[model samples]
Target chain A: MSTSSDEPAMGAKKVEGAGEPIPPGKPMTMEQHIVDKGAMMLQRLKPMKQISQHGCSFAIYSHDMTRQIETHHYCTRINQDFLQCAVYDSDGSHGRLIGVEYIVSDKTFEALPPDEQKLWHSHAYEIKSGLWVNPRVPEVVVKPELENLAKSYGKFWCTWQLDRGDRLPIGTPALMVSPQGVNMGVPSPELVRTRDLKYNILTEAIRDSRVEIAEPEWLNPMADYWKQHGKGFKIDVEPVDMKLRAPFP
Target chain B: MSQHPEVPGDPTATTTSLLEKATASIQRFGPISHIHQHLCAFHFYSHDMTRQVEAHHFCGHLNEEVRQCLIYNSPEPDARLIGIEYIVTETLFDMLPDEEKPMWHSHDYEVKGGYLFMPGIPGPVERQDMEKVAKTYGKTIHFWQVDRGDNLPLGIPQIMFALTREGQLYDELAQDVERRYKVSFAAEKEKRKDIEGPEMGRHPLANGAGKGLQTVLKEVDVKPPSGTTPRVFV
Candidate 1:
């Protein structure tokens, strides 16, 4: 199997102007330096402890199918049907926290207003095609979870354009989608191969194992609107008139 | 891994438990180790003040002046992820365009009033961080409306606002949080009297002062023709 770590052919083109590292500023004072060091040691971080699952998957820009990114999800399942994930560029301490994705079951996804439904993409193809995986856990142990996720839908928002080599998170958040099929080359073979090589797993084997996980027939027609309408949502900053209210003196 | 007895009909529960143990390990969650602060607060709908929701913020500092947070309905293990809040320093907020300022709400009121707090950290230790937070401004978007009793997060995302003045927050809600967390907002507010507010004063357009704002999702070309940006409808 090819183990090339080269960038995808599409990423060669600069999408957004890559951000430069923040320039060094004035040196910190003795007090500023000591206080900064002390703060980290004194506080107890409890909320971060709630994250209970890790899965790796690939996503395409909902607005443009050609742009794709590998997502590392550290998730918290609020119930049997709902999950929220903190997505990163890699499964390492230095990986950029690029975005967040929320997953809901078929019943929940079906309940959303049609326009809202357009913002989410189904996980059926991702699961069955072996594009989504839980790393480090045995397949037997992770099977049930994958079964639940296969019937789910996700709404992902990307804050950092790491794929374009941006040094910092710039621009408005971009909505993301899961590739519904291989026909459009959304999850390009190279991308899947890169991930498979890194994890030491075989995509074809995983795909064979997930064949019994039946696809849900209740998928909302409006979901994955990018594919359906050939259009996507784009967020931007535009100028506006001012309205002011005075504050307390 | 801990063992579980086989259920009457279902058979995957044991494997599921083991899966949970594997993923929950610190080694597995190492990528998100930077999430080090937990701030509990409340948010009211930007378009409607009467619709209030408690927000528990699990945040990480991206730099000295910026922090990103995941807002959940509660701090419990099964808490619902209702929204996201991005906090920026006055410097960064000032760089935003005039039209974008209204989307952000100042933290002065929430922080100084003790309406925002750290759950398990010591008061003195947490207070130091709160001092920095007091000068920050947050732009929040809530996807789930727990107050509306929606079993799941539904409809389009809504812009959220922080309480700017006293009495704007519901009395019953504050009392309930006080009762459950065993922390008095009144006392915390009194102790935080010395934290300074922004030196340049609050942005007039912030907190949706005179008019409220709501997010309207419109379908447009993902990449608009070059040099022409889509018009934003407020």
Candidate 2:
């Protein structure tokens, strides 16, 4: 019964032509009336709390380890085992919906068949290395949240390969993987610097903040696996001294 | 015991060798490193259809314009690979052929109604993101009707998505997702108060009334491959 005052009444029309003669009044069609009512009703409806409202940022890489992208993830917890994330290119309102990610607990990951399991990537490295972060949250709260996220596994598919210069999402969706071990893939130095400057925190410094959060036993299998089969390379894992860097220009 | 060349005679040497082999075996299973994001959401065969299925989507962002998600039956490890969903912007949707246009469903209704949701996202951020998502469109087809208890993906792939409007969605289906996920649609609806609903008339291609699968099927004049009746959950 309630309605917003701003809404235009159904079938209301304004004459536009200054020189042309006005036409005789025409009755609104049944379909037009119905559509207008539906629109009006929907306008007054409130949003649902089915998904979580919080947004977090992640520095993600391509499946082939070719490019690094900074994405904003707005996630909703479905249950104990699953969390669905809506991915975007930025935290701003104009950010594009680039992809979606699903995070599952270790128990759910284990239940997957071998081939299916291979399609999913682990969050252990991201968590342990502190590459994944909730930069918006206060420092005090972020540690515990990061520790909690450390224990889960995530699978990401990026539909828009912006790096390839495709205006629209075309072709197959590429499977994205997290950086592994000390040898996390090549993230653009400029992009990382820009993100770090915006958040005013470094990945290494964030990683160091959680040095005391013990690694769960579930991570052992994957750690051992990476030791054996992971690409043998090393990237800088040093924590940046925040005091030493110049203030943002 | 000392005869084998690989096995050293010294007690310390033997212990070290055994430790090395144990480490090697443990490392053989290796680390999983391809998938980047995980999402769990509900998908129905058609906007007008009532049957809703939960999907665990493993996705990768190819660029700013496209996201490809591999849909699964469940979040469990044994979850079957049921289908793939390709999400695109309005710019992309407009580029598609008329035939291809009907295959994709607009997110306007689903987002405004709060039916299409990403479960782990917080309410405020999700609302903001939904505004953007509402403008986009998705084309999905499920090869497996796993929710119907079919052991294998039976029959031809059926186009599936979320209901566009309130009455089109069955109460039972909405309740089922709510009960399983410990979420309330009523609460979600309340949280989405500020997001403006899509203007239906402006986007004829995205309109739910004429673009639903039923209407599309009628327009195309094709029956879903002979033996299979489109599964409709009460």
Candidate 3:
């Protein structure tokens, strides 16, 4: 399902801007911020990095170029929501990416496959109540797409370009799951919940209005994860203005 | 190799000029009447809403609330959420000068005035507290222009916001312009001349009319007519 070949780490700070080259650095945690070299605020979250030292690896992808990665999914069940994002590396590859679950509405959840009910519970298994827990992906949904990339370029992703003056705002990002996988829009089953104390604080953190971009805190539960294994990997992120329309096709 | 030549994207050397040549034939033409579909990005502070507005009023829409929902709810089958206005950035134009008044003016009171009136200097502003100068004072209104690829303050946005998301007042005017100038012009040209070729012809009554008619036409040139105040805000 994954694309082959793991390029050296990228230098991009905000992965949104096109034409900019990536710089380099090791991923480290500093408060909520994922401090690294040359990265700027992605406007997606206050502290852009969401790396956890736990077994689950969080992957992040740049929004600028289509860095090689495994399978991609066009979420069907979800009625076209928006996704805000940042980039992360796992397995130490620049593309050892994981998407820190992006934003979507509750109405987006009601319509999904029953298998997700079980899978989502698995992802949020560690959490307590009052706060909504994350959903988990079922093995059926995750399997084939979970296959490792030919090399090890993890998932690449980012949010929709909602602010435009000339065209229909772009839709949210698609998940780069494995090749043979299906994308059920905003998998309600696969989302994870927050620790109650951290939930309110993280919520406020979102509003306090800081910005972040890199971290390997979250994992896709898919294989080929490097962060969970505690391997030290250097990554790079940069902002770019990529005209996403295609002639490249 | 590819047999077809590449289509030109920059309109100034292409679309705009073509419209100009068809002033009399088209039913419509204007900035707002244009249709586009593209993508863009924008930023909005949490302050834009309130618990009085929303319970988590001051909480963030970015990392927190929305993500929380996504993490918890986990959409399925049809996960793609449809059209919803997440964060809207209506360009807030602040304190405009007299020189810029001829074509544009959206008043903003926060920047109070006292004119020293120096040559080529801009108009003045007097404020009680510079700290009080949050960006809340400016006026956000419908802005229009013909240049598509022009550099805009916000990066290139999607097509819906730029074309279809216009406020009501600008919507009517934009439609009027398009109908009268672009569409009607083409139809008229097709009726009277070779639709296959590009040409601007003499007026019906002026057919075979002399240089005098041509001179009168020059005198009657149309200005970019401004309509009566159309309350463009919702």
Candidate closest to the true structure, highest lDDT: 1
The clash count for each model shown is 0, 59, 113
Off by over 4 Å in 1: A1-19, A22-47, A94-98, A107-116, A159-174, A182-185, A189-205, A208-220, A234-249, B1-15, B221-234
Candidate 2 lDDT, tens digit per residue, A139-229?
5644544555677777665644554443443333344555555333435557667778876878777678777876867652432122224
Model 3 ranges with Cα > 4 A deviation = A1-157, A160-249, B1-80, B83-159, B162-234
TM-scores, in order shown? 0.78, 0.46, 0.18
- CA lDDT for candidate 1: 0.70
- Predictions in order: chain A TM-score: 0.82, 0.66, 0.20
Docking class of 1: incorrect
Cα error, candidate 1, residue A4 (Å): 34
Top candidate on DockQ is 1
For residues A95-159, write the lDDT of model 1, one tens digit per residue. 66677788977877766778788888889989888888888777776788888888889988776
Tally clashes: model 1: 0
* Ranked candidates, highest lDDT first: 1, 2, 3
Question: Where is model 2 chain B poorest over a 10-residue stretch in terms of lDDT?
Answer: B1-10
DockQ of each: 0.19, 0.03, 0.02
Q: Rate the local accuracy (lDDT) of all candidates.
A: 0.70, 0.49, 0.19
lDDT of 2 by residue, B1-234 (tens): 110112111232343234323333332110111133444556765433546676666543334445456576655433455666766667656665443455566776666566666555555545655675666677675655666665433333455655556666557766877787677777766766566644342245433324344311100111222334333211
